[model samples]
Target: MITLDLTLPDTRYPIHIGHGLLDQVELILPHLRIPQVAIITNDVVAPLYLQRLTQQLEKHGVRTIPVVLPDGEEHKNWQTLNLIFDALLAANAERKTTLIALGGGVIGDMTGFAAACYQRGAPFIQIPTTLLAQVDSSVGGKTAINHPLGKNMIGAFYQPQLVVADMDLLATLPERELSAGIAEIIKYGLLGDIDFLGWLEANMDKLRARDPVALQYAVRRSCEMKAEIVGQDEKEQGVRALLNLGHTFGHAIEAGLGYGKWLHGEAVGAGMVLAAAASQAMGWLTADDVARVQALIAAAGLPIRSPDFGAAEWLRHMGHDKKVESGVIRFVLLQQLGQAVIQPGLPATLLESLFHSPHIDPALARQ
Candidate 1:
């Protein structure tokens, strides 16, 4: 097992990553403030992991209330969030009751938000089953439910008490789900770690094949990178925004297509390519750089180009992004490979030109 620490202004927590970690209840029990807990999972993940996890907790003498929500990004909204509240209130959970998020990013996000809002606040732990969550979403304190107009429009920055990432859970992930996670893993490289990007290019086949060593290194390193960034700028006051390198474009795509239509990581894969292409047009990145970025994303089995939502429609969705300040949408753009910056007030004409570019491949757009 490998352990990493995230020290922020208001809190400090450990991120534990390894195989079979979930079966060891001792690791989780110490983090809880009380013996009673509520677990928020999804229908799909419940069948696969809920029983075993519950058994482990009960063996440790921890009482649990399991709330199994419908699975998918579409379900990440006020309606589903209310279900967590309903279960928590019905169970008579108190402020000290820790919430255990036992699924992928969707579960982790909603559960964390619930913990943050319930009785003003409560502690929570993230047991992220998907690669995307373990490497990115689960580690960071950003928790949110999707709004109709934008992805993650409703949320909080509530940190988990501890993050228990059991890589063994990934063994059952669907192929597309696994591919979607690689998109976020690649974002770590694009945002700040050029060396990691090279490593990914070299060992992507091993990752895709689910080699244990490759998977472990990918998750460990991704967590370390995120922890460091979050520690430096916990509230996204500055450097932390770099973490959203592909998210702006990705969120726009998600909202334009409707949430859950395209997986978050899949949209990010295509979004990164668009960001790179835009950088190229601005003379910061070369055409070769753009091609390399697209190739790497494609290697992970993610789409390289997005459906052309057109400039006006694209702007409409992007304007709803949380990064927007005073109606000006801030974009996290690449100055070069592995270097990201937040730029706002970009001219609308440049966006229009990029949208009309032939490289976007209309044939590739999903209809």
Candidate 2:
């Protein structure tokens, strides 16, 4: 087990990454303010993990309330959030009742938001079951549900008491979902670590094969990078925004496609390619650099081509991005393969040209 601490200005939490963590109830025991917890999951994850987690906690004399929600990004909304409230209220849950998210990103986000709103505030823990969650969403405190106007527009930065990223849980993850997780891991490398990026390039095959050693190293390194950035700017006042390298465009894809159409990581995969092309246009990256980005994304089994939503429609959707300031949409663009910069007030013509650019076309990217 590799344990790392995410130290914030006021508080810190331990991120436990290993196999068989779910069996170690003692890890969770210390973080609980009370002996009761609400395990929030989805229908898909509940059958696989909810019962086992519940059994483990119950054996320790902890009361468990399982709230199973519908799965999918489309269901992440007011109606679905209220389901958690209903379960908690019926069970007489209180501020001391810790909410344990036992699924992937959706479950974690809703559970954290529920805890934050429940009785003004309550403690929560994250047991992220998906790769994307473990590497990114689970570490950072950014929790949210998708809004029709924007993805994650309505949400809060509510840190968890602890994060348990059990590698064993990923054994059941579907291939598509596994590929989705790799997108975020690749993001960490692309945004900052050149050596890690090279490592990923060399080990993409091993990662695809689900080699345990490679998985552990990837998760640990991704968590370390996120922890460092988040600790420095917990509220995204500065450096933290760099973490959204592909998110501004990615979020627009999610919302414009009506949510759940493309998995978040898949959208991010294509979005990163678009960002790379935009960088090329600005003379920050060469065409070869953009091709490398596209190659890596395709190698990971993710889409390199973004849907042609047209520039006007694209802007309409992206206008709701959280990174916008003073009505100017801020983009996290690449200055180089291993570096990122936040830029605003990009030329309208430049954006329009990229919108119609062959670089974003599926046929060209595929070729």
Candidate 3:
């Protein structure tokens, strides 16, 4: 078990990471001071663990309601968010009602968004089920649905009361999701900590084997690193954007491909590879560094190659990226592992080569 503190300017919250954390939820939840509770999940995740969570809440005498949305990233939008409001209204859930995000990133984002908008903002708890959620989306209070125009554009930066990661539940996750989560784990190592990256390389096999001890350590370290950065820059005025190291490029791939065709982490995994290559091309990193990053990503079951989109279409996708300011596309580049820098003056020739390169093959990425 590992406890990490996320200290923001207004308040601080503890993010608990370990196996069998669901059992400890009731003792932990009441501290949020929520009068009512709503568990937001998806069709896929609800059946697997919802009953256990709901039972725990009921045993604690909490009024619990369940709202299960359709499974898939494509469903993460306003229509789905409306369903949550409908449930809250029907249950007469007030501002004190806490929303529990009971699934992966989608559930966490949607439920948190609903909590933010409920009566002009309520409290939320993150119970991230997937490895992707456990490490990335659960800790940050970035709640949003994908806009037709952009991803996470219409979201609020609302903080959650608590983040509970029940690592045991991840055992039932599909292999692809497990693989996807590794992408974010690797991102942490790539962007900030060379030591953690080295640790991941050493324990990659153990992680795939679902070794409880190894996963617990990985989750704990990742959260601690993120908490430190988020504490320093809660609203993304500076260092926080570094966390989106691969996301700027990844979001473009997701939006272009239409979300759900590729997993979020998978796209980011490939994006990191592309970004690394771009940095190398721009003389920010060595070719050997880019190769090393690729080798590690490929070992983790992530997509190391970009898709084979033409220059125009790729630009069409990347042009809509939210990180772009004044129509200039910006990217977070890895100068090396454990260090990331964002560059806004990326050359158009790089984009042209990126699209034209035969190396960009989605199939090649999908081990």
Candidate 4:
């Protein structure tokens, strides 16, 4: 088992990564604040791994309440969030009751948000099943649901008690979902680690083939990078914004496509390409660097080009982005490969040209 600690100013938690770690009760029991444990999952995930997790918790004499919601990003909203609250209320769960997020990014985000708001905050554990959740969403305490206007527009910075990432769970992931996870993994490399980017380039094939060692290292390195960044700036007051390298454009794509149509990771992959293109336009990145970024994303079987949403539509969706400050949208732009910076009030001409560019698929272009 490999363990990495995420130490923040107000809290700290350990992320445990290994095969079959879910069945190891001792690793989880220590983090429970109470005897009642609530497992929040989705329909897709409950049948796959929930029973085993419940059985493991039961072995430790803990009561389990399983709350399974519909599986999909479409359901990640206030309505679904209310289901968790309703379940907790019906179970007579107290603030001491520990909530366990037992699925992918949607489950982890909603469950963490539920924990944050339930009884003014209850502690929760993350048992991220999907590769996307295990490497990215599950580690950082940034929890939220999609607002009609934008993605993750509603949420909080609530930390988990512990993060249990069992690499074995990834074996069940759909091919598209696995590729989506690679998008976030690539974000870490793009944002600040050139060496890691090179490594990803060298091992892209192994990752796609589901090589065990590659999977473990990707998760570990992503977690380590997040831990270090979160420790430095817990609330995104500063350097943490760098972690959102492709997210602003990515979120816009999600909101534009109407959440669930394009998976978060797919949108991110394309968004990173867009961001790289934007960086090249601003003279920070060369054509070769942009090509490298696009090549890596495409090699991972992820989309590198966005749907052709018109400049007006793109502007409208981006207007709702969380990074907007004083009515100006702030973009995370590449200073170069492996380094990023926040660029606010990006020139309108550049933005419009990017939105109307031929890089976008013509079929998706506005009428």
Candidate 5:
């Protein structure tokens, strides 16, 4: 196992990346200094891996309580989160009882939120099953559930006690889901590391095939980059927003289509294309820059064109995004590869025209 330490202001945690790390769950949990455990998983994940995880906890002499939620972004809401709290309460789970998030981003975020709110707060470990979760969501302590008005509008900045990413679990991921994770990995390269992006472009096929070394490098590098960013801005006051490069438009897509219509990474992939294109149109980025980014995102098996949301609705959705402040929407646009700048005070109409522009082939847009 490769372990990296993440040093946030008031908290320190380790990110473990390896094959079969889940088998070492017992050794992993004790470090969190907890006496009891509550695992929040989903029906999809629990049926396949729950028995082994439950047994492992039992072996460690930790009393285990499981709350299995229905899996999907749509199910990431107060109702499901309430059930987790109710279950923990029924189990008499205490302030110090640790919560193990045993699924992807949705499960991790909801579990983290539950731990944050349960008895004011409790420690939690992230066991991210999907690529998006492992590389992006799980490591950063950004826990959230979807709001009726916006994606990730209701959430907390609650860090995990530990983050264990078992690459073996990704073997069972569906092809589409695997592709979605690749989008975030590509983001790590595009937003900060040109060398990593070059490496990804060269070895993407191996990553798609799930070769262990390639997966490890990608997973480890992505996690370390995020850890470094989070360490610098533990509460996302500034600098951390760099991580939201594609998220503004992505969140709008999620809200417009309804969450889960497009996987978060998928939307982010497309959103990156628009942000890049917008950067070009604004004359801040060259055409070659936009093309390079578009090519990389397309190579990752993610859609590179904006979906066919009406211009009016898209404007309205962006208005509801949490990043909007004082009625102005801010966007992270590319100044160049491995470079980004946050552009603020953009009129929604300017963005709408950019997405609707003729330079982009509307033929590629999703109906």
Candidate 6:
């Protein structure tokens, strides 16, 4: 088992990445303020992991409350979030009651938000079951539910007590979901780690084949990069925003497609491609660089082309992005592969031209 520490200015927590972590109750025992926990998951993940986790905790004499929510990005809203509150209130959960997120990003976000809001604040733990969650969402402490206006517009920077990223859990992850997770891993490489990026390029096939060694290295490296950035700027005051590499455009795609239509990672895949193309247009990257970005995304089994939302509609959806400041949308663009920059006040004509740019146009990209 490999452990990485996220040492923030205020607090520090351990992110445990390895096989069979769920079976290790001692790891979770130390983090719980009380002997009680509320395991928040979804219908899909519950059948697979909820019972096993519950059994492991219960054997240690910890009281466990299972709160199963509906799965999907579309359900990440007020109504769904309220379900957690209902379970907590009914169970007489208190500030000491640790909320354990046992599913993927959705479950983790909602549970963390619940813990933050419950009795003003409560401790929480993240046992992220998906690749995307383990490598990115589970480590960062950025918790949110999707708003119709924009993805993750309503959320908080609430950190967890501990994060358990059990590689064994990923064995059941669907191929599409696995590919989605790789998108974020690729993001870490693209944003700051050129060596890791090259490694991914060489080992893409091994990663796709789910080689245990490759998976562990990818997860560890991705977590290390995120932990470093997040430690420096926990609230996204500066460098942390670079982590959003493709998120501004990706969030627009999620909102434009009405949520859940395209998996977050898939949207990010195409979004990164668009960002790369934009960089080329700005003279930061060459045409070959953009092609390389697109090729990597395609190799990951993600979409390289975005759905055509038209210029006006695209702008409308992106206008609500959390990165927008003073009505100017800040973009996390690349100055070069492995170096990201946050820039605002892009020219209206430049955006108009990008809308018609081959990278943004699905039909044109295919041709």
lDDT of each: 0.91, 0.91, 0.85, 0.92, 0.85, 0.90
Per-candidate TM equals 0.98, 0.98, 0.96, 0.98, 0.95, 0.98
Model 5 lDDT tens row, 230-293: 9999887778888998888888878877777788888899888888888887777788888887
Cα lDDT tens digits for candidate 2, 33-62: 989999999999999999899999999999
Better of 3 and 4 by TM-score: 4
Q: Positional deviation of 346 in candidate 3, in angstroms?
A: 0.7
How many angstroms is residue 204 displaced in model 4 relative to the true structure, after the best TM-score fit? 0.5
Q: What is the lDDT, from 0 to 100, of the residue 352 in candidate 3?
A: 72
Give candidate 2 misplaced runs (Cα > 4 Å): 361-367
Task: Pick out the ten consecutive residues of candidate 2 with the lowest summed lDDT.
Answer: 358-367
Residues 1-367, candidate 4: write the lDDT tens digits: 9999999878888999999898998998988888789999999999999899899889789999999999999899999999999999999999999999999999999999999999999999999999889989998799999999889989999999999999999998999999999999999999989999999999999999999999999999999999999889888988888888878888888888888888899989999999999999999999999999999999999998888878888888889987788999989999999999999878999988887665577664332
Clashing pairs in 3: none
TM-score of 1: 0.98
Best by lDDT: 4
lDDT of 4: 0.92
Q: Which lDDT tens digits does candidate 1 get at residues 1-367?
A: 9999999988999999999998988999988888999999999999999999999999889999999999999999999999999999999999999999999999999999999999999999999999999899998799999989889988999999999999999999998989899999999998888999999999999999999999999999999999999999988888988888888889988888878888999989988988888888777899999888989999999988787877888889888887899999888888999988888857777788878876465654465
Candidate 2 CA-lDDT value: 0.91
lDDT of 6 by residue, 294-363 (tens): 8899999999888778889889988998888999999988899989888895778878888887666655
Worst lDDT 10-window in candidate 5 = 358-367
Give Cα distance to truth, residue 153, candidate 4, Å: 1.1
**Off by more than 4 A, model 4:** 365-367
TM-score of model 6 vs. true structure: 0.98
TM-score of 5: 0.95
Worst 10 residues of 3 by lDDT: 358-367
